[model samples]
Target chain A: MKLLEDRIRRDGRILGTEVLKVDSFLNHQIDPELMAAIGKEFARLFADKKIDKILTVESSGIAPAVFTGLSLHVPVVFARKNKSLTLPDDVWTADVYSFTKEITNHIMIDHRFLVAGESILLIDDFLANGQAIEGLLSITQQAEAEVVGVGIVIEKTFQKGRQLLDGLGVEVESLARITSFDEGKVSFLS
Target chain B: MKLLEDRIRRDGRILGTEVLKVDSFLNHQIDPELMAAIGKEFARLFADKKIDKILTVESSGIAPAVFTGLSLHVPVVFARKNKSLTLPDDVWTADVYSFTKEITNHIMIDHRFLVAGESILLIDDFLANGQAIEGLLSITQQAEAEVVGVGIVIEKTFQKGRQLLDGLGVEVESLARITSFDEGKVSFLS
Candidate 1:
């Protein structure tokens, strides 16, 4: 976690007040070494949990999810952003509103992949408004699967995402939590 | 390569005459152990090339790209399907037509991540009509980066993807090459 926080502090860019761009090593461009370390941390945190599968959304979440899946020695199921022709007939879907894109899109996972009573861990790159996490949780519920926990690489703590998840009583672990970004200077929480 | 070919023969699904779905292990749900093996295989194939980065499209390609990047100890840069606020101002973009989706969409990569003259290895989950690979190649060319080679997990030999790449003189290595899939029986070309 210290390594992730340090990397964020060094490479993360503060765009205005509400946005943090980590394209250099987190999202768009991935540092596989750092990602492996982060994956190890998540695996260490949830080592005791019975995680049958790792779930995440498309694009950004795929990197960390793959690493976490590797560490946990489980299969990673990524929800596709759009319904492709190749998708199976039976699927569990939820509408997620993207604050960054300002559009509502459906994320889906084939029902055949997630079984009933399976334990799943959700992973993602960023948690801002918690909409994406909420959608993933909805899909898990639909499948009758148990969400063991949520692992996030970077979290915007100043936002209500953590509060929302806390209200739901879900255990959330974040590598780096942003406390504030005032005048382009970033601060960490705790 | 035998391991991958066996996986495709065992788990891959043939949908009509056009689509071959490997959702069980390749795309929607990923087997990390198999992916690690694939990463090792890719490393073996491209051992001679000095690859500075691994480039691929988002979603499915991220998993294998992550593993490949881990083996090579390099960064993995994934081109995002949609333009988000987090994306940098300057970008190298390309239009990719999805054979399955029946629509053309643009993929973008941040200009800062790809440096000119850097050797990159393009990796993907599938190579159908070669449109996605062509799009990735276009983005790399726009950034003035040298594409050392292209690696695909599964290649449909019946399609024109390989021919297109062969025309370009790009060294392509597919773990499993599909010769045909008729009456639910899949045949491998290599």
Candidate 2:
């Protein structure tokens, strides 16, 4: 966790008073070694939970979720943002509203992949408004799967996402928690 | 390679005579243990190439590329399919036509991640028509980067992609090479 927090401090860029651009290392351009470490840390944190599978959204969440799947020896399922020709008809889906893109993406997972009564661990890159996580949770609930926990790479505590998850009573673990941004500097929650 | 081939044979679904659905392991729902092996295999294949970075497109490509980056100890940069508010205006952009989706996506790579004269190894989930690879190649060329080789998870020899890459005189290594699909059965190229 300290490793991630330190790297974030050194490489992370602040956009205005809200966005923390980690495309340099976390999302767009990835450092696999760092991702591997982050994966191991997530594995350590959720070692006690009964995680049958790990779920995440496509594009950004696949890297961290897959590495965590590697360490945990579980399968990682990424909810697709779009309905592709290859995708089948039977699927569990939910709509996610992205505040940044200002678009509502219909995210779905194949029903064959997620079974009822399976223990799911939701992993993601950032937890800001919590729309993505909420969508995944909705799908899991529809599938009758139990969401055991959530592992976030970076979380903005100032946002409403943290409170939303807290109200749901799910155990959320974020590697780096940002409390506020002061003068283009990140302030982590102590 | 045997492991991956075996996985495809076991879990891969043949849709009609052209499509091979590998969402069970390769793309949608990922098996990290297999992915780790895949990473090691790609590293072994490109060990001789001086790869300064691993480049691929976002979503599906991130999994294999990140794992490959881990094995090679290099940075992995995935071209974003869409431009977000966080992305800077300065970027190398290309238009990729997805035959499956019937859409032209404007993929971009931040100019800061890729450097001139750096050797890059292009990684992707599938090489059907080689449109994604060609797009990445164009971006790399625009950035003045050298593409040393390409690592593909699956290659359809029946498609024109192989011939295109061959004509370009670029070294390509595909983990599973499919010669044809006979009556819903996959035939691998030996």
Candidate 3:
């Protein structure tokens, strides 16, 4: 976790006061070694829980989720944003609104992949307003799977995402939590 | 490679004559163990090459790319389908046409991640018509990166993908190569 925080501070760019661009290492251009470390950290954090599978949204979350799945020795299932021709018809889906994209999209998972009673750990790259996490939680609930915990690479604590997950009584683990961004200077939640 | 062929035969579904869905283990619901096997296989195939980084497109390719990066002890860089707020302006991009989606979308990678003369291995889930591979090749050319080879989980040999790559003199290693899919039967090139 300290490594991730340090990396974020060194490589992360603050866009104005709200957006944090970690494309240099986290999202677009991934640091696989760092991802492996974060994955180990998540595994350590959720060591008590029996995680049967790891679930995440497509595009950004796949790398860390795959790494986490590797550390946990579990399969990683990514929810697809678009309904592709290859996707199965029988799916568990949820409508998620992307604040950045400003559009609502359906994230779906094949019903066969998520079995009932399986313990799942949801992983994501960023947690801003919690819409993506909510969507993943909805899919997990629909599958009757138990969510052991949610692992996040970076979280904006000033946002309502943490409170929303807390309201749902979900155990959320974040490697880096941003407390505030003032005049382009970022502060972390101690 | 045999492991991958076995997986495809067991879990892969042949939809009509055009689509084969392996969402059970490859793309949608990923098997990390199997992915590790595939990654090891890729590493073995490209072991002689000096791979600086693993390059892939977003969504499906991320899983194997991550595993491959882990096996090779290198970073993985994925080209995003759409430009997001987090994406930097200094990027190498290309437009790709998805025959499945019947739409043309732009894929971009930050210039910071891909440097000139770096050896990159392009990883993808499927190699069908080679349009995606061509786009990636174009992006690599733009960045002046040397594409060591292309690694594909499955290749539809009946399609023009292989021929296109051959025309470009790019070496392609496909774990499972499908010769044809006709009359609900899938044939592999042995």
Candidate 4:
């Protein structure tokens, strides 16, 4: 977590009051070495949980989730995002509204991947509004799977996302927790 | 490569004639261990090339590209797929047509990641119609970056993808090459 926080301080770009762009290393252009270390850290954090598989959304989440899956020795399933409201058959689906993009996407996972009673650990790049994680949790519930915990790469603590997850009583762990963006700079939650 | 071939032989599902669904390991439901092995294989295959970065499309390509980036000690940049034709500023973009999905996607890479004269290794999950790689190549060209080689997880030799890459004079290495899907069974190009 220190490494991640340090990297965020060094490379993260602050946009307006609440936006943090880590495209240089975390999301768009990825640092695989850092991802491997993050994977190890997540593995250590969730060492006690019985995780059958790791679940995440497509694109950004796949990198961290796969590395964590390697460290945890589990399979990873990424929920695909479909912009249309018309849901596909034979898949566990949930609608996620992204405040940044200002659009609602129907995220889905093929029913063949997740099974009943399977233990899943959700992973994502950033926990802003928690809409993405909420969608994953919805699909997990639909499949009758158990969520052991949620692992986030970067979390905005000032946002409503953390509070929402806390209300659900889900154990959430983020490598870097941002308290605020003061004077166009990142302020980590100590 | 043998490990991957064996995995496909055992787990890959054959649809009708030409389609091979490898959702269990390669794409949707990913096995990180296998992906690690794949990363190592790609590293070995491209060991001679002076690769400054690894490039691939988002979602499915991130897993293998990150693993390969870890092994190669380089950064991985995934091109984002934008459905809308409206191009964003300050990014290198290319249009790709997916034969399977029958849709055209404009893939974009941030200009900050790729630099002129930088050597890049293009990585992807599958090589069917080569449109994805073609798009990446186009973007690389736009950035004036040199593509050293291409690493593909699975290649359908019968498809036009292989021939297209061959025509472009790009060095391509596929871990598992499928000659045909005869009688709903996979046949390796060995």
Interface RMSD of each: 0.8, 0.6, 1.2, 0.5
Inter-residue clash pairs, candidate 4 = none
lDDT of 1 by residue, A1-190 (tens): 7888888889989888899999999889999899888889999998888899999998888888888888999999999886343444688988888888778878899999988999989999998999999999999999999998999999999887888788876678898898888888778888
C-alpha TM-scores of all predictions = 0.95, 0.96, 0.93, 0.99
Highest-scoring model, TM-score: 4
Off by over 4 Å in 1: A83-89, B83-89
DockQ of all predictions against the true structure, Cα-based: 0.85, 0.91, 0.77, 0.94
Tell me the number of clashing residue pairs for each predicted model: 0, 0, 0, 0
**Prediction 4 global C-alpha lDDT:** 0.93
Candidate 1 chain B has its poorest 10 consecutive residues by lDDT at B80-89
Q: Give the DockQ-based CAPRI class for model 3.
A: medium
Quantify how close model 3 is to the true structure by its C-alpha RMSD in Å.
2.6
Q: Per-residue alpha-carbon lDDT of model 1 for B93-179, expressed as tens digits? A: 888888787777789988898889999999999988999999999999989999999999988898999998998876889988888
The chain B TM-scores of all candidates, as shown, are 0.95, 0.96, 0.95, 0.98
Cα RMSD of all models vs. native, in order, equals 2.3, 2.1, 2.6, 0.9
Task: List residue ranges in candidate 2 displaced over 4 A.
Answer: A83-88, B83-88
- Better DockQ candidate (3, 4): 4
- Residue A135 alpha-carbon offset, candidate 3, angstroms: 1.0
* 10 residues in a row with least lDDT, candidate 3 chain B: B82-91
Cα error, residue B19 of model 3, in Å, equals 2.0
Best prediction by DockQ: 4
TM-score of the second chain of model 2 compared to its true counterpart:
0.96
